[model samples]
Target: MKRFVILIFIISLLFTGCWDKREINQLAFVQGLGIERGKDDMIHLIVQILKPGLLAAGGGGAGGTGGGSAVGKPYAVFQASGVDFAKAFANLNDELPRSLFMQYNEIIFLEEKFARSGIYKTLDFMTRNPEFRRTAYILVVTGGSLQELFDLPNTKQLERYPYKEVLGMIENQKNTSSSYVCDLNEFLEMLEIPKEAPITGRLEIVKKDGKAIGVRMAGSAVFNNDKLVGFLEEQDTKAIMTLKNKLRRSTLTLDKGLKGEKVHISFVVIKAHTDIIPKVKGKDIFFDIKINIETHMNEQESKYDLTEPKNLEKLQLLINDKIKQGIEHALFVLQKKYNADVVGFINILHQKNPKLWKEVEKDWDKIYPEVKFNVTVKSIVRRTGLSSKPIQPR
Candidate 1:
């Protein structure tokens, strides 16, 4: 037995081979990837690679400032065109001295046009490749091209890390309070299901002073199966987020119960639970959504005294109404206009009442639009923060 154990250990030691090993200088770490379908009917691939010099500079602190500033373009962008994804990736590698490593890639930006056409090929290539991680975040670029978004001087260049910058924007769960950060795995999983849709973050420029300043994560790109269908505005996505219990923090603007002024209040979500009560009467089916949210006030811009029980109760009712409005708007756009089930109602049915779902699976699209939604939102304001009223009015 001791000889057998020694033999197994020796075999395991031999399994570690130097054949696949690569040195640091021989491998290039890809931070971001952008894919777009060109007008010439080919795939345009763009990649952002990290440089060792900038990392060295960042690692050495203030003392390593010498000659590091001259190492221009902290990350380099390489573009290539090919007949298909595999060819495009190979062409990208042809342009680089070292192999383009993709395991560390954080973000993949797909053009709206490309995503709308279909993503089966791209997704297949990404998933089949051993080097690409399934967890990488995917964003759909809108209002502009992928190259234009990448060409900006400040983006993925100069001193900042673009991967971290954009990834940070999506990962900042509390600050966003509204954006959908959909990963490749989550998207793939959605594609495998029937009567369900996938949603991703929208990368676009925010206008300032009648001019475009910089790109920000805004809205959501809705997908029905593998093709892009439509986009949900910030307000609509917030409603979906609320239903999914993914609302981290939000600034709710209540236009009621304040007598005159609209109340602008920010709050951190303590807990949000949603229950989809599927109603079935004969062959007719609809959904009743129950959203229970607990939040404490962070900042309030209304003159209502949150300390008073009556006023606070009224404020909570108003908030509940606003939340309902948002949910209705989202349901209208998704179920009526787009007829996409990005809210996972189909999965809810499958989990809760699988027998009914099997019968209704074939005609979910037609059934979904006609389905009625009863959004019941109950919200409470637990804290009033430092001030009970707005600092504006005396």
Candidate 2:
């Protein structure tokens, strides 16, 4: 029994040893930033790999200390191309001894041309890769190369790129409802459904002094079957946010009967709700969307009496009109200009009235351009900031 126990202890020690061992110092830490493109019918991969040592040193300073981003030869931005994504990555491995690791990858940028060609193939690689995170943010770059995106200046002190900085800003903004950070799984799920259109973050390089300077989230890219269909500008994106009940705290400027003077009102979204009702009459599908929004004034530019019911009524009407117009324009652009149903209105109709959807499912896109949509926006301005009256005296 003593001999058996000794043998068993030896076996346990052997099993405890790591069979697949890797040193953190030898591995490259990827900080969620990459760009994907196509050239000569092959996949092009550009990775913005993070430098851990520099990141550590920079973060070690005072919490808010700043000194023009850590100056270490820390990050290595590289590019490679091949017939398949894996092969391209494998080719990259030939250059560096350490394997290409993407566990911390945060954002995926797809060029417009490549997106129009079809993203399913590239997305397949990302989704199937065991090491890739399912929640990495996805963006569509307009009229720029993967190299251009990588060349943007690093203004943050933590050795971060513009892509990460912009996304951080959007996440930290007061209005967080409509502005969501989409990942591989979320985008793929939305694309798989036939009735829904997928939206992705849009990026563009802003140049200054003959150099790539900054990055901006221009708007949202509306997709149809993984193809580039169209984009919703800033205003349209905001409108979609309102309809989707995603607005956090946004300002609405209104013309208050004064020529060349407008009232800038900041409001925090208190409550938001949306309802869709479908009606069919002789092959015509009519959708009525009712949106109820409640807000508190964060600021009022002009002097106005808040206690007056009449003024409040006018303010409510103006808010409703602005929201309605924004929605109407977005829908029109989606239907006529892009021929894409990005708002998932068709899906809503199908869910609410499946029978009608079944009948029109086959020809929904063809009929979408002609479908009549009625939108009703109801807004209630519940509070007028800390002071009941505007600071500017009447």
Candidate 3:
């Protein structure tokens, strides 16, 4: 009987609930975080805290809207400043009654000014902190106030949080291929690579009468090490994504001369592939880039039937030219204009030809500009949409 009681007591200890469990009511859930430079060289931190009470009220199909946003704001934004991120966070925590919970944070916004100044310290702090979430998507805020971005009224009817709207925007990149998105982990990994620069989605403010009305994620912010070097516009961003093989799906439009008249042709790119081969001829180094694309004819404004083999072949050639031009433009900007290698050129050489990489690793910066690229593109229009040819005007 004594042994049985001791065994039972020891088993009960194993079933003890979480030792440091925190009640939901005692924690403030942070949905998003924004960092920027402040006056007197202080670190400015902005946090978006979820309002549980409002969320609860918005539930149960409120107002026949089926769980839409509440009448009032579902989140609140707060800002604090200090000499460093840790102190800034401590100051912010003092203003709230509940402890800040950041494990659920979905987004991290770095203001343009702060990114330009340098993001190494901020990134280091985040990586070192156990509470910070490394999976959070990182964005560079431009042409707006970080606070306003967090506090802006939700335009999406079903979204209860501003960050969710941003998430949807980021998700659209899979189809649009107009912007670049990078999470904390991916950005850090890029930074650690040699001769490879880091980039993040560009979040720009849209305003009405000098007040921020909304935000748009278009283009990308390029970086050299941890500092901002420049930006890639939407077209350039698309080209870069294509070269990097990150473009999942995209639409392209071209005006081609058909039957002695110019007509518009739209295509939906369903598949794309890019290959880069590094070669060394004596002391000179160069690369061969081949881009293969498969697209479907989406729209035709003319009466001509482009599905015919000859016409289709001509259309494919035009598409190949257009894609080639875009890729060349992107290469010119990345190599000649910025001199930043964000396209992973060094990685290819290192993986394929380590011996050559070792010899040029010391003076890659000087050698990269002179490195020529031989580009070839092959595009095919696989299928035409419902209407093979446009209706006659007759």
Number of the top-ranking candidate, with lDDT as the measure:
3
In Å, residue 368's CA in model 1 sits off its true spot by 0.9
* Candidate order by decreasing TM-score: 3, 1, 2
Task: Highest TM-score: give the candidate number.
Answer: 3
**Candidate 3 accuracy as lDDT:** 0.85
For candidate 2, the lDDT comes to 0.72
Q: 142-202 in candidate 2: lDDT tens per residue?
A: 7567687776655622434544565565575435443434678888888987867788777
Candidate order (lDDT): 3, 1, 2
Cα deviation of 241, candidate 3, in Å: 1.2
Give me the runs in candidate 3 sitting further than 4 Å from their true place.
Answer: 1-19, 55-71, 155-158, 258-261
Full-model lDDT, candidate 1: 0.78
Q: Candidate 1: which pairs clash?
A: none
Report the candidate with higher TM-score, 1 versus 3.
Answer: 3
Task: Kindly list the per-residue Cα lDDT of model 3 for residues 226-334, writing each as its tens digit.
Answer: 9998899988898888888988999998876455368788899999999999988888888999999999988887777765678778778889988989988888888
> How would you encode candidate 1's per-residue C-alpha lDDT over 1-394 as one tens digit per residue?
9999999999999998797877877887888899999868899898887776665566422112223443555677789999888899999999889988888887899999999988899899988898998889999988776766665656433235556667767867455566787889988998888879988888885545644445778888999888999898898988888887777776666554456565566666677778888878777787889998887777665566666788887778877887888889899999877889998888888888989989888988888888888789898777667777657644
> What are the Cα lDDT values of the candidates?
0.78, 0.72, 0.85
